[model samples]
Target: MITWLTIIGMGVITYAIRLAPIVLLERFALSPALRQALKFVPVAVLSAIILPELIMPGGGVDVSLANGRLLAGLLAIFVAWRTKNVLWTIVVGMVALWLL
Candidate 1:
């Protein structure tokens, strides 16, 4: 019961925190420069989360050829760059990882 209550409380707090930003932003218009900068936020955040996992899949930095994740990520990057298709990138990356 205590754990459930704690989880519910945390969920409410997290929801409120995220909701406040959208509510406040809706009331005011952002600058052009700020809007442009915001477009890169998702990419930056994803890179921050994914790059480390790919480079260090075992919780330790491993940039050698033996690291399947690192190799797959590099191949994914190449696919994304060449094809510019998200679906293809994901498919190729997963297949590369599985085969490796």
Candidate 2:
């Protein structure tokens, strides 16, 4: 039927999308700037997601003691800056959240 045909067509399109990048990128190298930008993309993406959860979990931009997520995020930032350990950062953030 039409629905089955549409599903098969979508499968082919998805496969082509996945294969195209591997086939295309194999013949090229990223420039230095592009490579650096790619490295920062994950940080930028995570910050975008985490910042909202931390700063505005309740839809409004709250910055008070009731905003425990924001304070815990700040503590996590401090732990990351001081020790640069992912484990310690999580522990500190968890403790801060529990305390707050």
Candidate 3:
């Protein structure tokens, strides 16, 4: 009973924490510069999350050919740059990783 209650309480708290931003931000208008900068937020966040795993798969930096993730990430980067297609990039990256 206590575990279930704790989980329910955590759910409510998490919901409120996420909802607070939307509720509070709705009242104000953001500046044009700030809005434009917000466009890069997703890219920055994604890079932050993905670059570490690709560059350092085993808790240490690995930039050589032995690193499958690094090679796959490089291929994905090239695909994204050349084709600008998310689907192709993902497919190629996954296939490369599996092969490597």
Instruction: Tell me the TM-score of each prediction against the true structure.
Output: 0.71, 0.68, 0.70
Off by over 4 Å in 2: 1-26
For residue 32, what is the lDDT in candidate 3? 100
The global Cα lDDT (0 to 1) of model 2 is 0.92
Query: Clashing residue pairs, candidate 2?
Result: none
**Stretch of 10 with least lDDT, candidate 1:** 21-30
Q: For candidate 2, lDDT tens digit of each residue in 1-100? A: 9999999999999898678768889755668998889899889999899889898989999989899999999999999999989999999999999999
Report the C-alpha displacement of residue 90, candidate 2, in angstroms: 0.6
Q: Provide the overall lDDT of each model, using Cα atoms, as 2-decimal numbers.
A: 0.94, 0.92, 0.94
- Across 27-51, the per-residue lDDT of candidate 1 in tens digits comes to 6567899899989999999999999
Clash tally, candidates in order? 0, 0, 0
Winner on lDDT between 2 and 3 is 3
| 89: Cα error in model 1, Å | 0.7
The TM-score leader among the candidates is 1
Estimate the overall C-alpha local distance difference test score of candidate 1.
0.94
Q: Which stretches of candidate 1 lie over 4 Å from their true place?
A: 1-26
Query: Of the pair 2 and 3, which is ahead by TM-score?
Result: 3
- After best superposition, candidate 1 residue 12: deviation in angstroms? 7.1
